[model samples]
Target chain A: MQQKQVLLLTKSIKEKAIKEFYSKERPTTLCIADLGCSSAELNTLGVVAELIETIENARQDLGNGSQEYQVYLNDLPGNDFNTIFRSIASFEDSLKKQIGSNNFGHCFVNGVPGSFYGRLFPTNHLHFVHSSYSLMWLSQVPIGIEDNKENIYIASTSPPNVTEAYYDQFEKDFTMFLSCRSKEVVPGGIMVLTILGRTSTEKYSKESSYEWDLLATVLNDMVLEGFIEEEKLHTFNIPQYTPSAEEIRFIMEKEGSFILSQVDVSEISWEANEHYYKNDLPKTAFTHYDFVKCMRSVAEPLLVNHFGESIIEELFKRYLETVQVAMTKEKNVFINVTVSLTRKG
Target chain B: MQQKQVLLLTKSIKEKAIKEFYSKERPTTLCIADLGCSSAELNTLGVVAELIETIENARQDLGNGSQEYQVYLNDLPGNDFNTIFRSIASFEDSLKKQIGSNNFGHCFVNGVPGSFYGRLFPTNHLHFVHSSYSLMWLSQVPIGIEDNKENIYIASTSPPNVTEAYYDQFEKDFTMFLSCRSKEVVPGGIMVLTILGRTSTEKYSKESSYEWDLLATVLNDMVLEGFIEEEKLHTFNIPQYTPSAEEIRFIMEKEGSFILSQVDVSEISWEANEHYYKNDLPKTAFTHYDFVKCMRSVAEPLLVNHFGESIIEELFKRYLETVQVAMTKEKNVFINVTVSLTRKG
Candidate 1:
């Protein structure tokens, strides 16, 4: 439901933060890949824009005409690489000219298309890694939270406590993340990770998603108005794996290599476009309350049951109203994102 | 001039910071004092509050309340000791009622009045020491930086740089501070220092001071309008010592034996109280920018020689108007403060 907003927020963070890592006369070869990058047409420019700025700044720092970089764009198979490539081609010439053709060259571009959940690159190959708005979506919903009838995970509930099963899954995933990066990045490489986090452990269960407060309000409103049955609501949960700061710190301590350099958390409002729809009432209600599409995965069985035959039409219809509601509300939901850990030698 | 502002800022910081070193359960037959404690109204209470919180949280770790403390309250001769004595009287009854009377019965309190820079108490008599907001003022300004006629140090523009002389004097004073504490505080004791600092070395120059800016602007305006000499304006400088964060770190490192646990730098707003005169100005200008006073320390001598007393007053009247004009246009200033380090154990 917050796909567009999430993308925009991530992009802005990327653009703003890249400057800090780039300096003149010392153009750093930044090798960044967005993990779990989904197939969404929107917000692609934001990420590209951020990378362009970073590369250009690095070239400028290299001075006169002496800088070069090998750019690697990585994402899952579902992401629209064709569109990304086409977009990069359009700006490549001007960038080369501005950076001085002799001193700089086209971002020697290549795509590494695969799941970031496992190994994708050679050992000690990257100098910098950046990922945004993606970690919360677990590779799979935790098996412990799964229900037999629907074969779906119903997130957390009334009392705030992370189901031990969910926490165990997150710990495993985080360890996997460390191992993957530890293999790919050399010692002293820099990483910028902005992920969803929880302030309290107890709050995690009752409000299951990393952004439970925000999504819960939307769901409760839907139930009160009868758009989504409270029983059906029990079948869904935000696809999330949020760890508290303390838990994350504890994991880092156990991992014992990465040093935390900076931690920043802020509330951001995402932008979305609202539009007209034909079916009016049912479509509008569906658009406003269907958190399921964002929550669904290709592997999750609930997607098949919920969408059945007219999935595309229904998903499109519901998205418009959600945007309208979010716009009318004068603000959108928020997530707590923390950036921590510096690569260590 | 900034006494009240410093007082309030220091107070708020104290309430939030951990009081691990100061506690009632810390057995000390020796009487400890926070001379120039400003108001030791909190001398023992601060310790007791920390002890209670710590003991309650880790009763097993502490075992029992067998440790007793004797706290002394001391300040400059004219300080408000009645309040300190009264607060002690009230806390005594409360302490006995809260913790078993016998557990805290050994505690004693007394007040001493004198300059901390001199022999305020007998030598080798104290077990712990704590002082704040009193270190910056020298027992007397160095014999230099003063004009023979005025007797007040016109240190504003004495040296072009932040001045090795200023740093030399600070080192001497700080060493005195440590030596004084070392004498009274037993071999195995802890001392915590929280002081103001600047993140950059740029704020110490005459050209940077707002008063200088105003005086220059007024001089320029007067020059353009054919009222004052440009050559005369060149003599003015600002008197201020805002050491950079690195400089402070260096000073502590030089003093040696201090382990830094946490250093928190917060940009404080002088407008914490809106009704105060300074609050009427931008917190930055008032808190960080008082370049006029800084300018006075340097410019007055030059003005006295060039413009003479009567014309100088007239020019200052116009300059004051220009300052108000500048301040009304823009207000907050930024200062960096670090609270870090532990005395070498």
Candidate 2:
């Protein structure tokens, strides 16, 4: 899901960067940042490479031939920094090989460990900022939602108060994020965010809440089979929320630091991986095994922390069976929202 | 010694910065770096604070109301970084108190750990570079000089070949330093360096080599007293060199990256600290006690590494007696050199 969204985000950046390059006196040095850049080698490097290639192409088109670049990769202090440092050499080498050393601008890549809720870089230092599939995560789980029994996230079964709490938390986090970036980003700088959200303005839209509902059902089944205690489900709430387009615009305007240039909503099938199947079968054909593997890679660490290591294999096996039965009844789709913003002068 | 030199170096920077600010389009964000900033709290913070105050004053004089700053402190990886990190908060707080928070520009200070002989910053990112009491120390002891018996540094009794090797190493290290800075610094940037050097062109001038001779004499006395092995003296050589003014200019031009702007040399009496002694005093105001305390603070670690810890007190006591007799003959003075350069366009 994130891979597909990243492609769309980079495409949008490519389209607008040329105009941004020429709109102001061209900066001799370009400063770009990726906030919440985790230490996943392939995905992180792919995003960075695409960003650099697009910026370089735009600079060439505008006849700004000698621009240098400084790229800052930021994440929390507890992130897997050793892995990122070990992989930097190959990332730089591959970029140089693909772009040709002479044609590519000089790039200095560095890591910044901190939260994005406050200042990171010097004031007016950054020219472009990009975040994808990251802003959906709140700083922490919303207050007063711990009693949302048997629900891991903002599900359809959650009470009205729980829904209000999640909405309020999202608004505060989004406003602070914008306020911090506004000080670091130069006037007229561009920021693009691809967030997980809902197509409708309903408080508990099925399209955005159904996935967590399915996850809760699997845990409840484990409880009945005596695989886990029932109280554990009530204690764990995912630090995540999906908002509607209107909610995002309201907070952005109230923050009063950015001008909304564009907002795009796209629908992607939950079985998007089926399109890459090598066998001669229908495009919609995907097994429960594939879906379970994808979910495990994304959620394994969080799950392992809550549930001990001994129960992981058994828990996911049961989850696979539950997901298989759901696929037969109806096709599930995810709504992704991409917003483009310009720093206000 | 270094505190006095830093004041002079920062004054030179203040005078030229206003002209540089007006000569070209003013930069919205100013980047400054101090290469070889070791973990000494008072000296390091004093140097940084003065540099920031001077730059801020220059910007105001030019009527540039708002300019942000990014300061990079560079040193080797093995330096005592914990001390520097612990001191940064107080450093920033003191600066804010002196210059009101609203009047001061936003300054971001970060540490860059590496050798300055190689690239440590993004290309063309830096506006000004300052180094003091640091460039005199070479990267390592010059090749083939380890066999200069009973001498730990450049001295009057050292052979001609030893002198030639030191000069050759200085030239190579200085050239590489310029080459790396050339790429990192913006065109028209200014660099100020205060180097320890000689007043005369002779390779073994007494003005530069006599201090080391005195140190060597004290060490030889320790060996005879059975406190340390004689062979230990032969294996130790300090990684230091003092070049002539002609050598510095030659390297600046030969590297072809910077133009020499100004070179100033001054002399200070070795007993300059004695001026603080006021009121009535005994005829023999020099007891070896004060001299030993000063030398131990500066050279204790180097001596302890060569000789055992048990001999430190005895060695410095003997060193003080020898220095007191030398001072009686004539007041010893050291020759200091300060050079300014501008990056070529």
Candidate 3:
């Protein structure tokens, strides 16, 4: 289980949001949900534990020890939500015993396993929302990215300004995101989103980003050597988005239903090294590492197509060399920015 | 000054010997001479040129009409007096004309210059030896490479290795190339040596190859912030050795006695295209615009001092971006190699 290093920059902004929620928009039963939650024992338990601590701390500080809260754990159907629900169940049981079940109530956690872009919770049923390292992924690639495919999941570099198709999809996904939140989140609910982004003014070219370039290079090597046909290349897409800070701010402010409270930016060093690949992360973030590991599955098909049976051995060698070189040379850093906003009551 | 292409790759092994002599041996001559001869341009003029044309037209009948040959223009100094003077000169230059009041019948002519690393002429006083692009510079680098004023020329990757130092020095200078040839040639003889070399090689470091790193990143802004200093760089060696082919084989076969042979090597390309700039090459040797203009000069100084002026403005900007992203990129072919020889005897 890899434990993600909490982004201190985003954490600071989140702290302010939590404060506003507890002070101004207090509810008898606060409904908090972290969307795109993957089922890792620690993520389910750790975040719940943190939420409990925050609520308790606020209650004790304000001399109002009678605040009730309900936390929700949600993710896509493919995510490990079952484990999350079980972990949440155990957590609630443990806390009910220690803190008087009646005085300090436990959260009624649920895993709404579906794409968060569309309607998930009933209208105006949510209070606080938090999403970390997610939301940037478009629901599906915009149309026309591939020669004949129906939907595009990844984008490739083409002639100048030819990514209009991907941008359109991103626009749809963002609009859906805003509308989805607008329906479920209470008028005064606060939402905090921390995702990847870029600062350069250059338009989004597939090869413009290091992550995209590395992936494309690897894939192209496979395609050129006949490991995988060109058709297979179009099947996959990085569901991530790299909105400039300005772009994100514009989207939220223009939506008009949400009032921007704060925006914080920082870099996340995620290179597989002593710090990242030691396999010492908390159980909560292990799912993220597992997702990264799944990428090897994608590379495997390409390798097998090119090198035949020798693909496995050759892949390991290439992977080792790549990891070594990447660890030493210009290690990867995930640029992160968090925006916190309150819905208009 | 004719432009050199890929012709040197086809030169015969015999001619290779003489050119080495004219460039490295520094022999003296009493008759004809070749100055600063280059392998690539050997066939651009003289006998080789005729040989190429003959080969090209071999399908038709051989040309008729023959004339006696007197002199052969070989190299600047020590050259192959045996072959250049005895055979190629007569066989190739079949046309001749009478030209003296004294009625001296000058059979095939011979002269080689530059550095006569081998013997050039006979024991007694004799005729001419020519050299072009052979011997006008140091044969090797100075003894203080490790002790250069800035300590920039450390032999090998670490401490200096004298053997490697010699190889390095040989690659750097072209003037100090006459000692042995000077002793072999007789008095009252002509010696022409054409050499190529630099003023110094101690200024650049290995990091120069990673230029894109320094130019396209924050390094540029850092320079603007007054972080880097400025300095000068100079090269004093020519990694090539041109010893008029004749001089070498002559020294090997005939202990000491040999005569002058006409020597000739082109020198025009040295100063051509002194001011041209292009982002991409046009499939030609002259396409290495950056190498001749900016790269060679800046490579050393920018790398050696860690604070040279190369960090200013665009250089730093480009360097940084290149470092952060471009340095990791790979290319298939990265180096160019060219060397040729000619027999002058």
Which of the predicted structures, 1 or 2, would earn the higher lDDT when compared with the native?
2
DockQ of predicted model 3: 0.00
Ranking by TM-score: 2, 3, 1
Q: How many residue pairs clash in each candidate?
A: 12, 0, 163
TM-scores for all predictions: 0.39, 0.64, 0.43
lDDT of 2 by residue, A224-341 (tens): 8888788877877878888888889999999999998878887776776554555677534567565567667666777788877877888788777777788778888777887888
Q: Is candidate 1 or 2 superior in DockQ?
A: 2
Better structure of 2 and 3 per TM-score: 2
* Weakest ten-residue segment in model 1 chain A by summed lDDT: A146-155
Off by over 4 Å in 2: A8-13, A18-25, A58-64, A81-89, A101-104, A214-235, A268-333, B1-30, B34-67, B73-173, B179-250, B253-345
Global lDDT of each candidate: 0.50, 0.74, 0.46
Q: What TM-score would you give candidate 3 relative to the actual structure? A: 0.43
**Which docking class does model 1 fall in?**
incorrect
Q: How far does residue A249 in candidate 3 sit from its true spot (Å)?
A: 1.3
Q: Which ten residues in a row have the lowest lDDT in candidate 2 chain A?
A: A14-23
lDDT of 2 by residue, B1-345 (tens): 434544554566535653464346467777788878777534776666776776666666666686677777767655554466556667878987876546676666655556787677887778888887678888988999865889877777788899888888999999999999998888888788877788888877878767778888888887888777888888877777888888899888999999888787766666544544445765346444444464465577777776769887777777788888887677666677778788899
